[model samples]
Target: MELKQLEYFIVVCEQGSFNRAAECLYTSQPNVSKVILSLERELGRPLFERSPRGLRITPYGRTVREYARVVLRHTAIIRSMADYGWGKKFSLATYPSNMIAHLLADFYTHWQERYVVEHYEGTVEEVSGLVARGQAELGIVYVAQRQLSSFRHILSHKKLVFQPLDVKEACIYVGPHHPYYVRDSIDFSQLSSQRFIGGVHDYFAVEHHLERVSLGAISTRDLNYAMHSNSDHVIISALLHTDLCSLGLNFMHQPYSHYDIKTLRINGCEPFLTIGCIRQEGEPHSEAADWFVEQFRQLL
Candidate 1:
């Protein structure tokens, strides 16, 4: 199939409906349907099962979807590499964190008119892949100390190196109305009854363990997850409006004070995580990339 066909197919799979996918692609529904029909005819395999109720992706479609995503990601990497150092575009990927978001905000304010910032947020593995594939100049992520050896080994295979910025203590975030608001420290045992806003589980299974110990030695898998999301905004809203607490590092809570969020150290257990940036080994950081990281160094 053509690249456009694969792109359209992936979008349809994500949107789960021809009409919605058409809307997203800014095309007519009939046009999408025609493309899918042509694709199925060529492949001699149905991608979607049609029924009176709705469309369901077939087993073959699920496999194709994964392959299509990899193809698109690789294509993007190629395009990005071809355009590297050509303009003011400075791309960076990062794990979701309020601290990084705040640093980016301040960085943009100084160079908004002069530079083009392409910022992406995801899990640690996703961020590393972006840098490894040359799609991003650098990636910022934190790793649990216990997992650092394995994490670094994986990065080495990807031709990337992680440079530690700081070691952060595990902290729990609570809203102003939370009962723990007045407390300066909370033990993992005391958090058993607390509702948590956990991360959305996906392909990165290792992140679950990393996220669990981010607030110290608690059995977060057994803790009540009131809501799960990958969006920082959603997590912040949950913390502000609901009684949902979040597990993270102390530095990650840098901007939480502005929102009246309290950061309490986890007692009895201390999980030290190294916050750092990853870049392709032997590749010098671009001026903009260095400047972006320098801001973080100043903050940390």
Candidate 2:
């Protein structure tokens, strides 16, 4: 009935045991049980079924659990907004690639006068999941043309809208010492036999572009992991030293070109990926979210 009681009920249901839930909530088991029993007494129906296997929410409890989650999320949002009003603090989530290049710095500097920024970096899927769970208000990710359908499912389930920020061709690059650096472009046939240093986090973006351009038909070279790393620095370091090639946006190519690395344009291939922002659809975002989105738009 009360917010505290509802919170306790939800935690118990999630933990599946009174003792576990009590530990999680940092309270005694008897207190947790008292709250749950009081809540059931007030509702005139049992909310859970208990057995040796642990606890299971009853049909009635399941229905309440869904609404309870919404209530808790809204409450947290209200608290966040209140804190922002007292002192400008905002949280954001993005992919590793974006952060590596300081893509969001301009926005952060502009908003620093009015807000404090807390940034989180993760894989594209992980970023989407955080947004879906209300852990983050916004997310940015790069999506290959081929992975559009998979992204659509994420957007659909999360009830989020995707807005494209920029699109650029994905080019192949090798270290400065590689023989390909002397040429403006390399033939697909030449690369077919070469080992590729693909990013695990951006594999979808890489694979989708390769398939679209029929890169597989040229030669059957095995993909070799010269160095596997999610960090952009490590990936770039590996690409700068060996015959292994990497695929990335055209804009990102120029900065690395000075390191003796060069990018080759794929013939008949539109190796482009889109960078975009995602926000939950039909949900009211905080004022901070609005300001951040506007800043991103300006940068794009």
Q: Judged by TM-score, which candidate is best?
A: 1
Estimate candidate 2's alpha-carbon lDDT, on a 0 to 1 scale. 0.70
The residue-by-residue lDDT of candidate 2 on 1-300, one tens digit each, is 688988998899888899999999999999999999999999999999978887788999999889989898788756654444444566667765642345456556666677666666677777776777666778877787667777878689878778788776656777776667677766665555566766554544454455455545342233344555666677767777766777665554233235656667765455457878778888778788877677555555
Estimate candidate 1's alpha-carbon lDDT, on a 0 to 1 scale. Answer: 0.80
The C-alpha lDDT values of all candidates are 0.80, 0.70
Return the lDDT, model 2, position 115: 67
Worst lDDT 10-window in candidate 2: 216-225
Find the candidate with the highest lDDT and give its number: 1
lDDT of 1 by residue, 1-300 (tens): 798899889999999999999999999999999999888898899999999888999999999899999999888778765543434777899877787777778878887766677788888888998898777898988877777899899999999998999877667889976888888988767777888886666433323553455443556455677788989999988888888898777754444357878788877545467888999999977888888888887777
As a TM-score, model 1 comes out at 0.77
What TM-score would each prediction reach against the true structure?
Answer: 0.77, 0.60
Model 2 TM-score, 2 decimals: 0.60
